[model samples]
Target: MKYQGSCHCGQVAYEVDGQLDGAMACNCSICQRKGSLMWFVPRDQLTLLTPESQMATYTFNKHVIQHHFCPTCGIHPFGEGSDPKGNRMAAVNVRCLEGIDLEAVPVKHFDGRAL
Candidate 1:
């Protein structure tokens, strides 16, 4: 399914083609703090609808994930990272997606904090 999302201040926007049934709640420090439920999709499945300058990238720890956010509102609508096999992917924040039923999607718990 196709979905549209944006940062809280509307400075950053994107369109993604994916499903919500597989959304996840990761226990990583950043994930826990942000409280964003994520869904992974191929990089090609997501398109940024906003100007590149409107978004800022942040990376920490191993510096693998490129965490993108709106500098204006500090809202992280999505992030980009590679899987173990080196395939690029997008980790979309399901909460940012439009018209999604939060209750209908099953949230998987990932022990990212333990990694």
Candidate 2:
């Protein structure tokens, strides 16, 4: 499935092809505060509509994961890595998705902060 998402300020927009069922909700500190649901994909599957310079990245603790957000709006749109093989992925904020019912999408929970 192809999904389109953008930042709250509409500065950053992107289209990605993947199944929503592939999404996961993590119980880590940042994820808990942001309440982000992730849709992980291979590096080849992700396409950024905006320029790389348009996004801002933040990482703390282990720093294996690259958390990308819109610098203009301060919304963490997606994330990548932390797993082996260096697979590029999108840990999108399900709340950022438009029109779909987030609660209807079944999700597996991960204890990210713990592991």
Candidate 3:
């Protein structure tokens, strides 16, 4: 399935193809404060609808993931990183997606703080 998402002010927009089986709620410092529910998908499955220059990137800890957000709205819509085997992945924030049934998607809690 394809999903459309954007930042709060619509400065950052994108289309992602995937079946959202569930989302992950991470307890890391940033994840905990941002309150994002992430749905992982292959990086190739995601297409940017807005200009990349409109967004900003942030990374911390091991600096493996590049968290992209809209500078105007300060909303994190997605992130990019590689899996253990080095396959590129995108972490889409389900909360930023349009017309999604948040209740229907199960969430698994991740102990990111312990990583």
Q: Evaluate residue 17 in candidate 3 and report its C-alpha lDDT on the 0 to 100 scale.
A: 97
Clashing pairs in 2: none
Candidate 3, after superposition: displacement of residue 48 in Å? 0.2
Put down candidate 3 lDDT per residue, 1-115, tens digits, no spaces. Answer: 9999999999999999989999999999999999999999999999999989999999998899999999888999999999999999999999999999999999999999998
**lDDT, candidate 2, 41-111, per-residue tens:** 66556677788899899998978788889999998877777447555555666666666687688888899
Tens digit of per-residue lDDT, candidate 1, span 1-115: 8999999989999999876667999989899999999999989999999898999999999999999999999999999999889999999999998898888889899999899
Give the lowest summed-lDDT range of ten residues in model 1: 17-26
Candidate 1 has a TM-score of: 0.96
Score residue 66 of candidate 3 by CA lDDT: 99
RMSD of each: 0.8, 1.7, 0.6
Q: Count the backbone clashes (under 3 Å) in each candidate.
A: 0, 0, 0
Clashing pairs in 1: none
Order by TM-score, highest first: 3, 1, 2
lDDT of 1: 0.93
lDDT of each: 0.93, 0.77, 0.96
Identify the superior model by lDDT, candidate 2 or candidate 3: 3
**Better by TM-score, candidate 3 or 2:** 3
Worst 10 residues of 2 by lDDT: 82-91
Considering lDDT, which of the candidate structures 1 and 2 is the better prediction for this target?
A: 1
